[model samples]
Target: MKNLFFSREKIVQTFETLQGLIDGIRADGKIKNEEVIALKSWVKAHNYLEMRRPFNDIINIVKTAVSDHVLSEDEILDIKYVCKKFLDTYGGSKMGHLHGFASGIASDGELNEVEWKSLAKWIHTYDYLRGSWPYDEINALVHKHRSTLDLSSEEKEIIIYYFNDFCGLNKNSSLTHPLNEPNKPITGICAVCPDIEVYERTFCLTGESKKYSRDEITDKIFECGGIYKNDMSNLIDYLVVCSEGSPMWIYSCYGRKVEKAIAMRKAGHPIQIIHEFDLLDALEDAA
Candidate 1:
């Protein structure tokens, strides 16, 4: 049963990656021959996922869409609809897709004028994400460099690093050389110390913690008269994001749960999203 659960999780993650790749290819508003080739290659590379429902469906759709070396508007819409249905069913977050889109656009290792403009347009289109972690940071970075004819090597590397970290792809090694200065601390984490409550309230966790295994965290929650849920929902009272980084995170420092919490909060649910440290403090206080 455990293995089956993990297998399903892997399939969903891969599907999200595919969505990101497709979004990246379309970012520039025009898909070139080479981009089509790249897309085909990506699908072929993930052919191992063919046994899964959506993968089987997506693989067939992509194969037919690009089989003739031409991607028509109808084909694009078909692919989009399939991906949308899967996301809607599985609760895929827009933030996750946004990070994937960033990773996709930068996968080629170059940011061109068209791609930059498209990225900016995307950020603007999702204005609701404005004050969230990484969104504001990314928005600023895109606008700051929009006027440049070509991004400097360092600038490009910074953007790439952001995308990699955001997409949980920065484990083991930096994608580029270490910067002389530290990268800015991620913003949009709750700026004020939240008054956290534990007893009888439901909690959902995202990202990874440097200090505790998930089981250990759940144990602590149980000990503190709190409940831990594996999925995010409107009933959750708090969404605890681990401050540490991990490759397992769908988004590096945060994940889909955080996005859902943000959306929930925006809708007036009073759900408090806090860092693991804040959770620790609350646990200690409860103790």
Candidate 2:
């Protein structure tokens, strides 16, 4: 508490102020309570000078929300993106730990970036986690960055904290591929994405497919900096396909058939691929 650069009371105040603005957005449109809370938490962690960009953009969103402006998912993500940039610049230690924890959550269960970020921030900042985490005298357990999803809290703390000791800081730990009934099933998602790298070797098929919900696919594209869209004209770089079953449908364009559909519409090809893939999944499967 000594020499505090930012106080908890002020942060909570900011959330309250933004909540009123967001209420206006919700009045015009259906802004979920969860999303509103996430936005407030993102704003609460930082000072105004550092948060201007996200805050201003959020204010605009509020104004737009009041008018029922067409807010795309990417635009909503921008709020989190800007907040992330702000946190990176301002230094988020517990936030950083939550960042890592969020990764594990995604590994075990399905979560969008927004949901993941929200979960991490909430777990780290809420009275439950902040007041409860045993920050002192970390027990040592060498985990080699192994997954602790199944471990009890005591076991997890021992594994993770000791993991820090074993691997040292800056260690890139690998996830454990466990075989068990309760474990995550094989959910492979094939994505035919555009070459999104800003450097050389651009415009090629991206590998490392996701396996789970479409949300996972979107998170992948977001990580790669690829934009997800509804059609060929906007499908700038990549065409993605994801499913919990059948990678073999790939030849028939299983998940990727949409791109082929758009191409077919332009060049004249078969259009049966749409029935095989879920249209709703394609739309929501983004960062």
Candidate 3:
């Protein structure tokens, strides 16, 4: 029984990774050689899970598809089908299901009125997911569009961009189809142009920064009269996530600190997960 439990836990974790990889690969709408290598590497890394049902089937499909070092459109579709099947059968957790559902809704590269209504209903049904990193944010965005009789092209673009980021899709994805304007704020970021109060708020940093070193960031926080902690805690008012090299996970970025911050936020902690650029802007304003 203990071994069975352990195996199940491992399977869930691995399955989540597999799902992320698939989303990232398909994000651009075309699989590249590097992506094929990544898929092959993922299969090889998680070979132990092959003894299971969907994993076994998934592994076989990936192996066969990549064996020729070329991923035809049809082959990619087959892999996505299997992954979707696995998601339907064993959709690990509510969060996982939310991610999968959002991906499915945006699969056609557009979110129609029907799909938006369906997604809104799903979000409403999962009231327990409220206050969570994405659930609350997504809920707000959905209702915002639903109330409007007609959405502008930019508004529609916002919906697509938000989901693409949430689903771990590359910003450069064909689906994003960047508009000729200033960069849109990342929807996943808790605060867009936040009024940063550094005087007394506690801050925590996660991921690497391209502009500043760890010590420099901590120094800046101190200089701005903010407290900097290396770890996340309830005391943390602002969790400044470095934009550089931060990989997007299903709910948050790829870090335990991020996961903890999201969990804490869901539990009623007023923790704001801001981007490094936000911090820089705050520092500049203070100066």
The lDDT per prediction is 0.67, 0.33, 0.64
On a 0 to 1 TM-score scale, where does candidate 1 land against the true structure? 0.49
Please give the lDDT score for candidate 3. Answer: 0.64
Per-residue lDDT tens digits of candidate 1, residues 3-39?
2334545556566666776788777777777667756
Residue pairs with backbone atoms closer than 3 Å in model 1 (clashes): none
Top candidate by TM-score: 1
Quick one: ranking by lDDT, best first?
A: 1, 3, 2
C-alpha lDDT of candidate 1 relative to the true structure: 0.67
The order by descending TM-score is 1, 3, 2
Q: In candidate 2, which residue ranges exceed 4 Å CA deviation?
A: 1-57, 62-71, 95-287
Q: Give the per-residue Cα lDDT of candidate 3 at 34.
A: 62
Q: After superposition, how far is residue 123 of candidate 3 from its true place, in Å?
A: 0.5
What is the lDDT for 175 in model 3? Answer: 24
lDDT for each residue of candidate 3 in 1-287, tens digit (9 for 90 to 100): 12333465445545555564565455545556766765666567656656765478888887898899987878877877876666566666566556545654454455566666767777788877654556656665665456324556555666655555444544353222344233433324444445578888899987778888989888988898888888888889988778674422223233478668866865568787777887888987875
Q: Alpha-carbon error at 82 in model 3, in Å?
A: 9.2
Poorest 10 consecutive residues by lDDT, candidate 3 = 245-254
Q: List the residue pairs that clash in candidate 2.
A: 187-211, 189-210, 194-237, 194-238, 218-286
lDDT winner, 1 or 2: 1
